[model samples]
Target: MGNVQLSLALSGYDHTRDLVEGRVATPGIDLVAIQLSIEEIFYRVAKFRDFDVAEFSFAKYVAMKDQDVNDITAIPVFPSRAFRQSSIYIRAGSPLRSPEDLREKRVGVPEWAQTASVWTRSWLHHEVGVRIQEIDWVQAGVSSPGRQEKVPLKIPVGVNYSSAPDRSLTEMLLDGTLDAVLSAHPPEPFKRGTGEIVQLFGDGGREEEAAYYQTTGLYPLMHVVTIKQDVLDAHPWVAGNLLAAFDRSKQNSLDRLADLNASRFPVPWLRDHLKDVERLFGGDPFPYGVEANRATVGKFLQFSYEQGVAARQLEVDDLFAPQTLSAYTL
Candidate 1:
C-alpha cells in the first residue's frame, strides 16, 4: 500500500524548516507540512481540529486534556522553547520596578491561559513572591483589539480577570491604564524599539540565564506537536513515525548551525553563540521524547495545575502518545 497522507500544520521555525523542505521524511506516511503563524495554528487546531497534525500550546493542550476532551494526542516534538523572563513588559518608567511591584496592580495578558503567561505567572508566584490573586488581571490582544481566550478557564477564587475587547494591552500600558503586560509577542511599539515600552527583566539574556540556573536548565517549552486522535486511531504507527522524523529534522538543523566553516545565520558570532548554547544545554539543546524532556514537561504540568489552568495535574504519559514515551535504542 502507498504511504498514508496527513496534513501537518506548524510554525516556520528553523528546526521545523527541514521537515517542511522535504529534507526529512516520515516513514510509512506522506506529511503535507503547512507552515503557519503560531496564533493561526493554535486557534485552528485547538478550536476546530483543522489539521491531521499540528503544533499546540503546552498549557492549552493540558487544559483540554484535563477537560476529558480526546480530540488529539501529542508527541514530544517541541517546535518552540522560549524563556518568558523577557515577556513581561511595562511602561518605560512605570513604578513597577520588579515582579513584586505587580501585586495589586493591573497587569494585562493576551490570554490568561497563554503558555508564556502561565510560565510568567509561575515565576511571579514562586520566584517573585507575587500570588496571581494579588493582581487585577486584564485580558486583551497585544496590539490589535478583540482577542478572546481560546480555552475555557477555571479561574481560581479571589482572582479578578476582566476582558478588554475594545482596548489592546499595548494601548492600555501606554495610556497608564495597565501597569504592565505579560505577552508571548511583544507589543508593536516595543518591537519597533520605541522607548515607551520596556521589558520587566532588564538585560533579558542575563536574567534568563540566572533564572535557568535557579530552576530547571530549560528555556521552557512553548509548543508541542500534536496529532488528531482519529488520525492516530486509524494509523497507530504514524505516531512513532512522525516522532522519529521530527527528531531527525531537528538534528539536521542543529548540524547545519554547528558547522563553523560557513555561518548559517546572518548574525555575527553565530558560531560562538552556538557553542555557548551547546556548552549550556549540551549537544541537543532541544531534544525530543518524553524522557529527554521529563523535567520540563513535569514542571509545566505542575505550573498548570497550580495556576488552575489544568483541571488536574497531568502526567507526561497522560499527555503524550504512548509510543513516543520511549525510543528504540540501538
Candidate 2:
C-alpha cells in the first residue's frame, strides 16, 4: 500500500526544515508540510482543523484538552521553546524596576491565554510574589489592532482584566496608558530602535534568565505538534513514526549548529555561542519526549489552571499521545 499522506502545518523553523524538506521522512507516512506563520496556522487549526497535523500553542492545546475537546492530540515534538523573561517590556526609565513593582500597575498582553504571557505571568506570580489579580491586565494586539484571545478563559475573581481591540498594546505602552507590556514578540518601538521602549531586563534578560533556568530548570515550552484524533485512531503507529521523524529533524538542526566548520547559520559568534549552549544546556537543548520535559510540562499545567487558561487542572499523563510517550525496548 502507498504511504499514508498526512497534511502538516507549522511555522518555519530550522529544526522543522528537515521534515518539511523531506530530509527526514515519517516511516509510514508522506507529509505534505505547509509552512505558515504561527498565528495563521493556529487560526486555521482552531477554526477549521485544516491540516491532519499541525503546530499548536501549548496553552491553547491544554485549554482545549482540559475542556474535553479531543478532536486533536498532541505529540511530544516541541518545535518552539524559549525563555520568556526577555518578552517583558517597559518604557525607558520606568519606575517599575522589578516585577514586584508591577503591583496595581497596568500591564498589556496580546492575549490572556497567550503561551508566552502564561509563562511570564507564572514567573510574576510565583517568583516575584506579584499575584496576577493584583495587576490590571489589558488585552490587545501586540503590534496591530484587534488581536483577540483564541480560547475562552475562566478568569478568577478580583482579577482586573479588560480589552482594547481598537488599540495595540505597543501603542498603549508608548502612550502611557499601560505601565508595561508582556509579549512573545517585541513591540514596534523596540524593534524600531527608537529608544522609546526597552525590555524590563537588559541583554534580553540573559543574566536573570540563566538564573531562572538554573533555579527552575524550565526552558518554557511554547508550542507542540498535534495530530487529529481520528487520524491517530486509524493509524496508531503514526504517532511514533511522526515523533521519530520530528526528533531526527531537530537533531539535524542541532548538528548543523554545533558544526562550527561551516557557516551553517549567519549568526555572528555562532561557534562561541554553540560551545556555551552545549556546556550549559547539554547536547540536546531542545529535548523531545514527555519524560524528558516532565517538569516543564507539569509546571505549565499547574499555572495554566491557576490562571484560568485551562478550565481545569490537567495531569501530566493527560496531554500527549500514548504511542509517543514510550518506545519499544532496545
- Identify the leading candidate in terms of lDDT: 2
RMSD, candidate 2, Å: 1.3
lDDT of 1 by residue, 1-330 (tens): 899999989888787788877888877888788988899999998778999999999888989998988889999999998888888899998777777788999999999889999988987887778999999999999999999998888888888999999999999999999999999999998899978999887786465655564566766889998999999898988999888888888888888887888878878888878777777776677888888889888988999988789878888889989888777778
The runs of at least 3 residues in candidate 1 whose Cα sits more than 4 Å from the true structure, single-residue gaps closed, are none
Question: Tens-digit lDDT track for model 2 on 11-32?
Answer: 9899989999999978889899
Candidate 1 lDDT score relative to the true structure: 0.87
Give all candidates' CA lDDT scores.
Answer: 0.87, 0.91
Q: How many residue pairs clash in each candidate?
A: 0, 0
RMSD of each: 1.4, 1.3
- What lDDT score goes with residue 69 in model 2? 89
